[model samples]
Structures are given as C-alpha cells and as structure tokens.
Target: MPTTARVVVLEGDFGVCAIQELELPDPGPHQAVLEIYAAGIEHGQLQQVEEPQPLPVIPGREGTARVLEVGSEVTRCKVDDVVLITPWSADPGREPELPLVEFDDGTETEVAPAGSWGTNLILDEQFVVPIPNLMDKEGASVLGNTTLFAASAVRTAGVGEGDSAAVFGCAGVGLSTIAAAAAAGAGTIIAVARDDERLEAATASGATETLNLSSAAAVERIAELVPGGVDHLFDCVYEFETASRPGRTPVRDGGSALVVGLPGTEERQDDLDA
Candidate 1:
C-alpha cells in the first residue's frame, strides 16, 4: 500500500522549493516507516539546491522520527522507538547504496530521498540509529551528522588524555570539535573564530581559550600560549591560504592537522606543506 506523504521538493537551481503530496511506498523486509518529528535544513542542503544539479529533487540529510511500522524481518527497532535519521552510517569510509526511485513519468533516479522534508519516511534499518528514550528529538536530529564529523576529526587527530587541541572556524562543526576534544580528555582546547559572539559561545562549550582570528597577532599569540604547539589542529573553515597556513604552525611537529571543511578549487601544495 502507498501512503500519502507531504514533502518539500526542490524544483530548480534557483533555490525554488515547494511542498507537494506524493505516495510513499510501504516498508520493505529490512525497512521501517517513521513519523518524522524534526528535520534540520543544513547549509549543505541549501547549497545543493542553489548549485546546478538535477531539478525536482528532495533536499535534507538529517532528521529524527518515531517508528510507526517495521518490516517483518526488521529487528533493530520496533514501533514507537525514536531514532535518528542520518545519511551517515557506522562506517564513514563507505557510501550507502540506497534503492532508486522510479517516477510516474518513467524516469528513474538513484539518489536516496529518505531525508526529504516530509511528514513521514520509509528508510532502511541500517540508516536509522536508535536514540535514548529521553533524548530530545530535535537535538538528536541535528546532532547526528555534525557530531559524527566532529568526533571523527578528533579521533583522527589522536586527541587523548593530557593532549591539547585547537579548533578553527567556530561554526557547528568547529564548536562540536571543541566539545568532543574536551570530552576526549584534551588538557587544553582552543577555539578560533572571526566573530566575537561565536568565540564566546565556543568558550561556553568547553573551550579553555578562544582566539579572535581577526587579530593580526592571532597565530603568534596561539604559538606563544602552546609554546611548541598543540597536539592536534582541526581546521574547520579550510581557508588553507589564510587560516590553515598559520593554523598549521600551532600544531606540534608530529601532531596531525585535520581539515574538516571544503577547500576551494585553487590547488596549492604550499598550503599542505604547512
């Protein structure tokens, strides 16, 4: 049976979006149907719709929902279980192979539209992670992707007990990196941002120190504080020429520099050499 679903659709590359009714298929043997509670409209989704791409696609990547129906073979979750819907899985290295959608016009698309801004969703059991019963639905929805990226960056940097780390950008990912570093037992955590207000928020989120990137002596100051430099440097902004260059120096010689943000088209070996 097909269920009536209300979904937000991206109509074109000019940022046009619309709400329309569609028929969602019932869950398969390894799938589950969920009543979506919250979905985050992230910047990446916005960029997707704004940039050139196939039109009439759904745009969203993270959300939370309550399971309403489970397929016969599904054992990971049951009815009424609140779960986080994310594009990511336990394995970060591999991409998910989602089933394709066949439109009524005989056109087929291979992308997974499960995260579409819809009232309900039919997703594979593997993409939905069960959350604690008491967890806030909205928070769990938005935290899934950003938290995974931040946590992975921290782990890749080898932050451990008594280690020190510095996070740049102070955006969602940067702030999360700071908190993750603190939780990982980093002895010192430095948050860097161009804005004063974001720096304050980073401090509240467990940053032992905050640096205003706008300051002319910001890099020098960071070097002075950490002496030889921190154990890890997380570049969340990825402004390689300006930010990552100076940012790299604050990392101890053997420490890793993790770039979390997207880089520009221009290639520069000098940036990586830092």
Candidate 2:
C-alpha cells in the first residue's frame, strides 16, 4: 500500500527548501520501507542545496530508522529492526546506481535524491545496515558516513600504531579522523584549523596538538613539532594552495597525503597540474 510522507524538497532554484506531502511507493522485491527516527544534517547537504539540481528533489544522505515492512526477497532485516541509512550499499559486492526520475515533460535526469528527511523511506536492503539495539538513532544517523569517511582516510594513509598524523580541518570528518587515528594507536595526532572552538573539540577528540592556520607561522610551527613532517597528512578541507604547497607541505617524503573532501573545479584542475 502506498503512503503519504512529509518530505523536505529542494526546488530547482538555489536555496529553496520546503516541506511537502508526497506519496511514497511500496517496497520493491529487494527493498524495505522504514520509519525514519532521525536524520543528520551536514555541510555537504548545505552545499547540495546551494548548487543547481533537478527540481523538487529530496535532499538527505544519512539517517536512522526502524524497518516497518520488507519485500519478499529481503532477508538481511526484518520488521521493527533498527537500521542506519547509508549513502551507499553496506554490501561491497553490489554497487547499484541511484534510480533516475522522469519529469512530466518526458525529460529524465539522474538526480541522486536521498529522501531520508521524509517520515518514511523505501530503500534497497543493501543500503540499510542493522544498528545495535542500545544505540541512539540520532548518533547512528551521523555515524554511518562520518565514521566511514574517517576510517577510509586512515586506511588510505596506512596510519598505524606509533605513526604520526596531521588532520587539516577540524570539522566533522576531520575530528572523526582524529578520533579514529587515536583509536588506531597513532603516536601523534595533530589537528589544524582556524576556529578555536573547533580546535578545542579536536583536542577532545584525541588531537595531541592543534594548529591555528590563521597564524602566519603555522606551517613552520608544524615542522618544528615534527622535524621531518608527519607520516600521514589527511587534507579534509582541500584548499588548493595550502594543500599543494611544497615549501609548506605537511607530509614527509614518500608519506601519503590523502584528500577526503571534494574540491572546486578550478582547484581540481590546479591539483591535477600539481
């Protein structure tokens, strides 16, 4: 049976977001319907809303919910199971592209709309990961993407016990990386940012040292702390000049500099050249 769901839709015009009622389709053969309990709002979602996209699309990427119904082929979860809604499938073997929506004008466009802000959601079983019984929904919602990104960054950098790491950016992803690095037994976790509050948060998250990028001698100070640069440099902000400067580079020779954030088109071009 179809159900009406209140969804936050972003119109084609930039910066227009509103709630509207829409009929949600029933779960497909390999899908499940969920009652969303909590959804996370991140800076990436804010950037998405500001960019031009297909009209009247739902804008959300991470959430937590309880399974209300499942299709016949679904076996990973059952009704009433708490699950985290991940942007990609939990199963690494399968990679399914987002479904394309066709407009009344007969024009079709591939809009990767995640309708998690709605009261209910119907997603493929692959995208839902069963959550622990004691975990809070709000925390679980942000955990999926935030932790995954941090873990991926650590893995990419090959950070290991007694290794030194420098995280450039004290935002959600950067702070998460610090925590993960600490948990992995990193010898020194340095957090770099401009904001004092975020720097403090970074310290609490397990940063052994913090650098204020606004300071004129910040790069020199980092070099002074770790004479030969850090073993791993996680660039979460992707600032073109700062991240690519050879004189002020944060990574040691042959060390990995992992960029985990999206850069602007011009910056990307510059990065390619560098």
Candidate 3:
C-alpha cells in the first residue's frame, strides 16, 4: 500500500496550489513519518516564489507534528511522540543551527531533507524537536524559530538594563520580540500597531507602553512616550508606511534600528532613504 498526502505546492511564478496524491516513502533508517498539526506561514515562502526556484515545490518552513512511524535506526521517537519540526535536520553531533541534511534532488529547498507542509511528511529524527510537556501544539509550532529570531534581534540591538526599546509590530513574532526585550531588561518597551487588541496583548506580554496607530501621528505618539528616543528600534512591521518610517526616527542619534521583518526588494530599497 502507498501513502498519499495533501500539500501546498508552488507550481511556477506566483503560483500556489493545493494538491493531493503526494507520494511519501516509508520511514527509512534515521527517518520518521510525521502527521502535521499546525504550520506557521513565514515570508521566506513568498520570497522563494517571487525569486523562482525549480518546479513543483512545497512552501512551508515550520510546523508541529506527531511521530507516526520511525525508521529502524530512529530511537528518539516512537509511534506517538509529539514533536516540533524544524525545517532543517542537522547532523546529530552538531547543534540544531547547522543542519546537514542533503539531497541529490538539486532543488533549493530550505529544509535539508525537504519539509513538513502537508498532512503528512517524512522527516529525519534529528530535525524533530520534542514539544515540551508544558507547551501546547500552537506554542510548539513556533518555539524554535520564534525563540531564535527573538534572541537574534535582541542581541543585534544590544538590549540591556537601562536601555529603551520599541517594537513596531504586534504579530506573534512581534509579541515574542516584546517578551524577549522585556526579559532582556530593557527599561522602557514600546509597542506600536493598528490593532488595539494586539497592542493590548503586547502590553500584557511585556510592553511598558502601547500606541495605537490606527488613526494618525503614530510616530509622534511613540516619540512622545520615548522622549529622548529609544536605544534600540525593533521594526517587525517594516512594510506598513507608518511603522516602517518610524524606526529611524524613534532611535536616538547613536541608537540602532534592527529590522526583524522580512521586506521585499523595493521596500528594502526604500529603507535606504531612512
């Protein structure tokens, strides 16, 4: 018997479609079959489409799953272990960041052994991070990537006690940035967004000040709260006109603007003007 699964495929230029009947091989040594639960949509997928790669590709970067089957050599998981699938599975001896999975398929897929964007996926045991006992499925779906990005942004901004910081978005990643910033001991944390609900969430997460930009003068409002300007500006809503333009303006003369959002080429070029 063969296993068929449904997956999202990018056929060609700006083309994304759902198709079933994907052929998946059974677990081989060091591999496992995953039953995917939730996947996060990141900007990498969109960029890959616009830039163009080989044909007939899947387009998700991260997800959580349950181990459905394990290869003979796989000892990390059994038939029902819950795990978070990082896009790339690295060599076991090396840390998770340096993934070593390779394929002769000659496609520039983000994951070393490809990825988990479908109802079912075959993954190497090394790529699967066990979901913590406390973390729910949604939490596990984004923990690894979200944690890495937050840590990277915080380090890039040099956040520390007595430093003032501002985050220009309140999406999941943006909220993660806020929590990381607060935990890093940033004296004043400001969050700006058009969503009142998200702003409230950011405040609860760690933001000392929340500004609703839904009306106007959003930057001015942020500036009023920061006074001398923030020590670090973390812009996650870099495409929105109001949020994008405020990063440079909100930073003190020597302060730095760390862009965490993924912007397109044109928008990035516009950032040069800042």
Candidate 4:
C-alpha cells in the first residue's frame, strides 16, 4: 500500500530546502512508515552539499516521528508509537523499494542517504528507537544524531564504570558524549567549553563537573581535580587552532585521548610542530 509523505528537498547546494509531497510505497517487511514531527540539521548536511551528488536530496539525518504504519514482521513498533529516527540502517543489504518516492512534478529518481527523509519516510525498525510518549519531540529529534555519534565514540574509547572522563566542546557531540559516558557509569565526567550555556547543557547531559576554558588553565584545573588525570579524554575541539593545546594531555599514562572534529590542514602541521 502506498501513502502520502511530506519532505523538505534541497534542490541544489546550501542548506536551504523546499517542502514537497511524495507518494510512499509499501515498506519492506522489516520496515515501518514514519511521520516526522521534528528534525535536526547536522554539520554533514551542509558539508555534503559541496561534494558531487544528485540534486533534490532530502536533508534531514535524524528526527522525531510517530509510527503511522508498520510492515508485516515488524515487531519493534506499532502505529502511533513515538520514535527517534537515526541514519544507521541495520539492514541495507536488502534492496529497498525506496528511491520509491514520486516527486510532485511527477518525476522519480534515486535518493541517497541524504534522502533519508525523516519528514516522512519509510524507515527500518533497527534505525528507530522507541521513545517515551511524553518526551519532548524537539529534544528527542536532536538527540538522535548526537547520541549516534557519541555512542560510537564512547564505545571506541572503551569508557568503563568508575572511570574518569573529560569531554571538550560541550556542544552537540560533546554534550552527547558526556551523557553517554555518564550512562556508562563513569565516576567523574568533566565538561570543558567556552560558553556558560553549553557548560550548563553538559551538566544536564550528565557531566559531573564543568569548566570554561577561557577562565583558567583548563588542563591544569583538570589535572588538579582528577589527581592522576582522567582515565579518558574526548577532545571535541581538536582543530588546527586548538590542536596543540594540552587539552588531550590530561589523560593518565595509560589512559586514552580521543581527538575529534573537522579542521583546516594548512596550519595543522605548523601548529602540531610547535
């Protein structure tokens, strides 16, 4: 059975998008049809526009939605269930009926991952997280991508119970990392950022402590608090300008520092050399 879905399309480069309607066809046996409530924009959405790709991409990567329908054999959710949509598709091996959407102009073409429209799209159950019905839709939407990235980083860093960890940046990924670390039962979670608002967000996200880098020697302050240094450090601001900073050095001798973030390369060599 086919259903109507609304989507925001970016006909060309830039983040600007236009809303349109599409006819969604029957979902795969393991898929569910999602009616989006809210979607969050990610950095990759903007960056991808510059790379070569087909035009008219659906721009949302993650979002909050309600299950309008489910295909046979789908057990994770049922109609009317609130959920979060993540870009990770657990089963991409199966040939999708998608790219199945027909544009309003009566044209049809393939849509890439960028076309993983949360506004209204058929999604795999594995990519959907069942959320509390009472949870704020906007917050749940933003958390999808953040949690996805944070979870992987935390897992890769091997954070453990009672371990001390510090996260720098305190924005989307940073805040989410703090939350993920806390969820992993980290003993002390330190959040370092330049803004008060972000630091506050980090605390709410589960940071046991917070620091504003502009006010003090962040590394020194962190070392003083953790004594032997934190067990792990997530340097979210690992860019050219801040690359050589001691932000990543506050880890203990055997501890790990996970450096992340996009950066310009021209000055990276010179800065790291200093």
lDDT of 3 by residue, 1-274 (tens): 2346676666667665555446566666787878888876666545655666666566666778888888888877788888877654446574332222222344434334335667877777877777664667866677556555776789888899978888888987789899998888988998888899999999999999888867577778767887888889887766666443664456788888877856645866577565
- The lDDT leader among the candidates is 2
1-274 in candidate 2: lDDT tens per residue? 8756777777668777777666556777777878899988887767867887657577787889999988888888999999888776666686543434443345454435256877977777887889886898888888766677788789877889998888888889899999999988899988888899999999999999998888777767778888888898887776636533323556788888877767646756576467
Number of backbone clashes in candidate 2: 0
Q: Clashing pairs in model 2?
A: none
Q: In model 3, where do residues sit more than 4 Å from their true spots? A: 1-4, 26-31, 42-51, 69-79, 88-114, 124-126, 142-147, 214-217, 240-244, 252-254, 265-267
Residue 60 lDDT in model 3? 66
Comparing 3 and 4 on lDDT, the stronger one: 4
lDDT of each: 0.76, 0.77, 0.71, 0.75
| Number of clashing pairs per prediction, in order | 0, 0, 0, 0
Q: Tens digits of per-residue lDDT for model 1 on 185-205?
A: 998888888899999999988
Candidate 1 overall Cα lDDT vs. reference? 0.76
> 47, model 4: CA deviation in Å?
3.5
Residue-level lDDT tens digits of model 4 in 122-181: 876877888999999987887777677788789889999999998878878888899899
Clashing pairs in 1: none
* Cα RMSD of predicted structure 3: 4.8
Better of 1 and 3 by lDDT: 1
Clashing pairs in model 3? Answer: none
